[model samples]
Target: MTAELLEFLEELSRALIASGNSVTDTERILWSVAESQGVEVEVSVLPTMIIIKAEGEVSRMGLAAQSPGMMPLHQVTEIYRLTDDVTSRRMEVGEALGELRGI
Candidate 1:
């Protein structure tokens, strides 16, 4: 996988965690998102971290910390849209990363 893809996966994990998803739920959701976009991804969710393997080439690991409470619906929806845009190629990795950071 390219560095951009790796970075994207890492950011995605962070977003999921920030959106109040448990580590296991984050892995499941991310895998489903990738598969829906026709991408193959392998995810391993540990007690405190998530590891994403993509394109059979690169693996990116990130810390997983759930927010104190539920995230607002709007923010969760926005994150889902951003993930879709990135995985579907509707947005560039850099652009998606920027948008995610802003969120």
Candidate 2:
């Protein structure tokens, strides 16, 4: 589950950044989503990469390559929707990953 959570977080951060969200906004969203799952995460979002450190019984760090870019308004909206679903627990990690990838 932790591994899945890390993968989901990385994907979510990348999507947010590519949608033109600022680092602060991305961090807040990640924190919210992690909190919903009762996980503590330290996330760093940059134009070139996203780094996430999850603290728990077994702590781990994951990185996802990111490139600075902007998406269409509709695509950005879809990404936000998926993020809301994850933060609200309306979607599971696997489901959210699929949805994010689809967007």
TM-score of every model versus the real structure: 0.72, 0.85
Kindly report which residue stretches of model 2 are placed more than 4 angstroms away from their true locations once superposed: 56-69
> Runs in model 1 with CA error above 4 Å?
22-25, 32-40, 55-58
Global lDDT scores for all candidate models: 0.76, 0.81
Best by TM-score: 2
Whole-model lDDT, candidate 1?
0.76
For residue 69, model 1's alpha carbon misses the true position, in angstroms, by: 2.6
C-alpha lDDT of residue 87 in model 2: 82
CA RMSD for every model?
Answer: 2.7, 2.3
